[model samples]
Target: MEIGKLPNDMLQNIILNKIKHFRNDILVRPGIGEDCCAIDFGEYSCVMSSDPITGASNEIGRLAVHVSCNDVATCGVEPLGLLVTILAPVYASEKEFDEIMGQICDTAASIGVDILGGHTEVTDAVNRFVITTTSVGKVLKDKLVVSSGANPGDDIIITKSAGIEGTAIIAHDREDFLLERLDAHDIERAKGFTGSLSVVKEGVIAGKLGASAMHDVTEGGILGAVWEVATASGLGAEIYRESIPVEDITQKICNIFDIDPLKLISSGCMLIACKNGNEMLKALEASGIKASRIGKMTEDKETFIISRGKKELVSQPGTDELYKAT
Candidate 1:
């Protein structure tokens, strides 16, 4: 019903209600916060995830690759290949099509992921180009991680600043509008947030070093992601608002649009659940990735945030704040 992700309750009732598990080898099935599905293959597992690029028109191709691959990374797997589907409007020009394809190719190459065969066609189904990608990756059977595995007392670690992807998308898509209201350097810095979208390195490091669970921050942002993790694990969380990192550029852009940076779509950031927060923090920092322990899981099944010496329950996420800004 909304522009972004479906509401969690309706999704559970309408979509997840009818789905049936038909296979026993399916290690990780569909669920809120479980973006990727993993199929057990004895000694190893294959992780697969599909996502479409619909939010940003400027970097559709790049976003498609990174977003799809990030799903696999959330499962703590190494993405090896991708299958892409392109739906173009009938009015799209040849140059535009080539540009999209070129961006996709360059992005996949940079990440060492091969673009397998896929279908592309121009039809009157929509007004603009829509790209979807199914990313495939592999992980050792013993090393697989899921969002539902978070245990009580585990530390919640967030990588990168909040609203990284949303900031980049807003800056790039609304460049003219932002330039009129903000410094050109700040806008440029926000635009460059796209370069830090991939979290494969940190995911691998955390997964291998004993992360209990991991969820890549996407449409719901950091707070939304934390809520999902707690829900999937049937636990609760106490998020410290002061500990959550927000870039100056992101804060400025979000303030301009009257949106909460914590509730904006964030693809570059990741939330990790681990027993030892200090160990994970050190590991991520050693790998040149900025991370912070912003919260902890609790046995109680209520999620809330602490700010200014006060605590407030976090409501279920609806449409991402990014949609309002756009």
Candidate 2:
């Protein structure tokens, strides 16, 4: 098995197949590309998502909150609260535990979300500290968005640049190694990429503007996200390779490791599908969020990435490139 997310096929065959949906109030259930689940709450739908921070050791608390909240935002809902669980190794110190809790508190405060309640304990079950966050949000039933809602002919828009999270993680966790081959200034800039790790604002804007679908770019990066959106919608996609934005620092770091920037993890980027892409782009610009229309959903059932007059079929995302670097 891979170190990151389960491959799409294994997830479908082993996990998704065994799960049964019994309640009528559940609007969304577990599925490929569907990060958040929405349950009917009368006039509103309560959205929730859970994610664990395991890839990086530096900012586990902060990343835990943002990653789960980003999943909730993918449904175009602003997260209101979080239930955080911490599992620390036996060798962990109280100071380290306090630091993690402080980060969780500070991050949740910054995002206007409350830390409701959760369990924390030090055990020998794991090697390092692992923080998992389950974020909760609410949205009107009529306005709820799902990753499978994308329609053919809708334009695909991406927010922010590629590999935003991976760049920051590698720069922070592998600073000593990077410092040997890269300039200090460049490494510092890459670490600063964490400042742009939230997609809640753009998610709300796109949702309010009637985006057909939205998927938060997480473990799989931009290309993997495009594949998920298309697969979940039962449609195909055509992405222009040159249109995907990549920061110079990110490129340099990836070049050092010989990894594909397109396949790297990108937490800050949001993948949106809408009928009026130009209007969506304008709205995002007005809000001061950088975005680009990289491609479109297609009637065909085969997804492809076109670059320099060549088309390459997109494969199901395997292990994330982040694992390789980390």
Per-model TM-score versus the true fold: 0.98, 0.99
Runs of candidate 2 with Cα error greater than 4 angstroms are none
Clashing pairs in 1: none
Which RMSD values do the candidates have, in order? Answer: 0.9, 0.7
Task: Supply every candidate's count of residue pairs whose N, Cα or C atoms clash at under 3 angstroms.
Answer: 0, 0
C-alpha local distance difference test of each model? 0.91, 0.94
> Which whole-number lDDT from 0 to 100 does residue 119 have in model 2?
89
| Quality of model 2 by C-alpha lDDT | 0.94
Model 1 alpha-carbon miss at residue 82, Å: 0.6
Candidate 1 residue runs with Cα over 4 Å from true position? none
Candidate 2, residues 58-145, lDDT tens digits: the string is: 9878898899999999999999999999999999998998898998998888889999998898889999999999999999999999
